[model samples]
Target: MDGFLDGLESKMRAKTVRDIRALRSNANLLREPHSKSMGEGLFELRVRQANGIVRVFFFFFAGRRIVVLSGFVKKSQKTPRSELRRALRYKADWEERFGHGRS
Candidate 1:
């Protein structure tokens, strides 16, 4: 996620960062245009700039915490399956490492 943010153009990166902060502030209340559900506990944080559209995949866990899985600069209308798979893999790894009963 850090790499993803770092790779963005300065303005886009700043905008994405602000969007992420907004997500942090209102994860439960966030809805379409800004965020959307991708099923299987996955949610997407959408960031659009003049350059392109970026997406960050995350899931709610450990009470109010949101676990970010993966991110990408969208190039098409539909998200690629490979990216989804990557995010799922990360989510599984996270569960294995920290999903244990800690809150």
Candidate 2:
């Protein structure tokens, strides 16, 4: 995710950071255009700028913490399966290390 953010252009990066802050502030208050669920405990934080759209995948962990898994720039109307798989893999790895679901 750090690499992803670093690769983004300045304006887009700033927008993405602002959107992420909004997500952290109140994920439940974020809906549609801003956030969307991918099912199976995964959600995407959507960040759109004049340049492009970005999606940061994350999941709620123990103590209601948001664990960001991966992020990618959206190049198509639909999200690529590979990215979803990658996020799921990260989620699995996190669960393995920290214990699944809520503590």
Candidate 3:
């Protein structure tokens, strides 16, 4: 939870709530402990699918529920490393300026 992921949880929650009210109800269900599956705890990425595209998202569950860490629309070339770096930097700047998710 360093860069872009810092405040992403709140963004996803807010946007997910404001734009997709219907889906909002289902979000909690998606947060179930067993709902998330991962081989190792190193990465806990989640994919939100819509139409024909998939939006990649991660969660920070070092707390009560899964907090959406960050998100991006999947690209054909597998999400360039530069983009990942930028995302991380963005998260860092956000934290430096605003603080954390609650901000």
Judging by lDDT, tell me the better candidate of 1 and 3: 1
Rank list by lDDT = 2, 1, 3
Tens digit of lDDT per residue, candidate 1, span 1-103? 8988899999999998898888778999989988999887789899999999999998888777888888999999998899988988888888888773256
Better of 2 and 3 by TM-score: 2
How do the residues 1-103 of candidate 2 rate in per-residue lDDT, one tens digit apiece?
Answer: 8899999999999998888877777887788988999988999999889999999998999756889889999999999999999999999999999898675
- Runs with alpha carbons beyond 4 Å of true place in candidate 1: 100-103
Residue 63 CA displacement from its true place in model 3, Å:
5.5
Distance from true location, Cα of 99 in model 3, Å: 3.3
Cα lDDT of all candidates, in order? Answer: 0.87, 0.90, 0.41
Clashing pairs in 1: none
Q: What is the TM-score of each candidate against the true structure?
A: 0.92, 0.94, 0.36
Model 2 error, position 70 (Å):
0.7
State the displacement of the C-alpha of residue 32, model 2, in Å, after optimal TM-score superposition: 0.4
Give the local distance difference test score of model 1: 0.87
lDDT of 3 at 79: 52
